[model samples]
Target: VRPGESTQDEPNQKWETEDWGIFSSKVRYAAEKQLDTAPLSQAITQLAISFVGTTYTPGTLEV
Candidate 1:
């Protein structure tokens, strides 16, 4: 498979309901604050910082 691509038979990363909620909130906040107008790096940094303290599971992409 191509980079970051998974097949139907492979185990893939799954987002829980809470994860979706967090994503939705971030998208809404970004829209409301017009973060899209900011420089790409700045916007990416802002979004990355917002995930502080989030739980991360390593090896999720491993087959």
Candidate 2:
């Protein structure tokens, strides 16, 4: 995973909340939503490509 830049030292420190419980819950919710949306996002991309159809014709490509 790409690491985000920190504006201060101890970058591992939670910036979300004073309570650990709240911070962890928010992280979990965000991660789950991203996971759920990933497949649909990929599907939409594939559908768009299918709609565009093949860009190359057979025998047109050569070594």
Candidate 3:
């Protein structure tokens, strides 16, 4: 949400659900491409979950 935007109007405001899904999908896709013979789907899913658990703040390091 943009500056001063209220969650009352945006159900997914504070959660950033779309970004999480997109990031998870991208990670899974990359893992699949890199480990084609032995698919890393489960691994990617776990890693994504772990990452989402971390407390995130603006300007923090990524990956």
Candidate 4:
């Protein structure tokens, strides 16, 4: 699905079908792409804040 990819291939279709939940619901199925404008640090901070009070194993991806 880079630039000129075909969907007629069976393997490609199978992989897409296998992960249909995430792909179909969340993904924006279009041929165009754009740059993300939001800053990475800010995004990470916002996401980390959500887990600030949650008890996760001491230091493993817990905010």
Candidate 5:
């Protein structure tokens, strides 16, 4: 959004909180949630399962 602002390749600069521009939050949120009363492994497993019905299109990432 400015002149001479080179499109530099860097980590967590432009999109520090986005995952594929969908849900946005830091990893600490998941870490803390997992570290709660539930075991981290279980939390991770359930979290992975939670996205079962979420929309996803093949080849989108291929571009």
Candidate 6:
């Protein structure tokens, strides 16, 4: 896919507690640190880097 494209067919995937925690923390951190002022690519790269070493679980997106 393209740089900003999602491979998932569904756009409304459910978010688990862990996902929410991570997302909220990222959002809060971004707001506190003014990450929104960064270029989109830079922000995306930073976010992707944060996921480094994260374990991939099959069927985690099943709903």
Q: Which candidate is the best by TM-score?
A: 1
Ranking by TM-score: 1, 6, 5, 4, 3, 2
lDDT of 4 by residue, 1-63 (tens): 432343565333333443454344323321122113447776555545544775656653332
Candidate 6: where are CA atoms >4 Å away? 1-13, 61-63
Alpha-carbon lDDT, every model:
0.75, 0.50, 0.58, 0.43, 0.52, 0.71
* Candidate 2 total steric clashes: 0
- In the predicted model 1, the residue pairs found to clash are none
For model 6, residues 2-62, the per-residue Cα lDDT tens digits are 3334447655554566666777888987787677998998888887777789887998745
Cα shift from native, residue 13, model 3 (Å): 11
TM-score of every prediction relative to native: 0.59, 0.27, 0.32, 0.32, 0.37, 0.58
Which candidate number maximizes lDDT?
Answer: 1
Worst 10 residues of 4 by lDDT: 26-35
lDDT of 4 at 9: 55
| Model 5 spans > 4 angstroms off | 1-13, 16-35, 58-63
| Candidate 1 local lDDT, 1-63, one digit each (tens) | 344455467647455666567778999988876899999998998888887997878975466
Q: Over the stretch 6-60, how does candidate 2's per-residue lDDT look in tens digits?
A: 3355555433333455446555655655544568777556444543644656863
| RMSD of each candidate relative to the true structure | 6.1, 16.2, 8.7, 10.8, 6.9, 8.1
Q: Name model 3 segments beyond 4 Å from true.
A: 1-15, 35-63
> Could you tell me the lDDT of residue 32 within candidate 5?
57
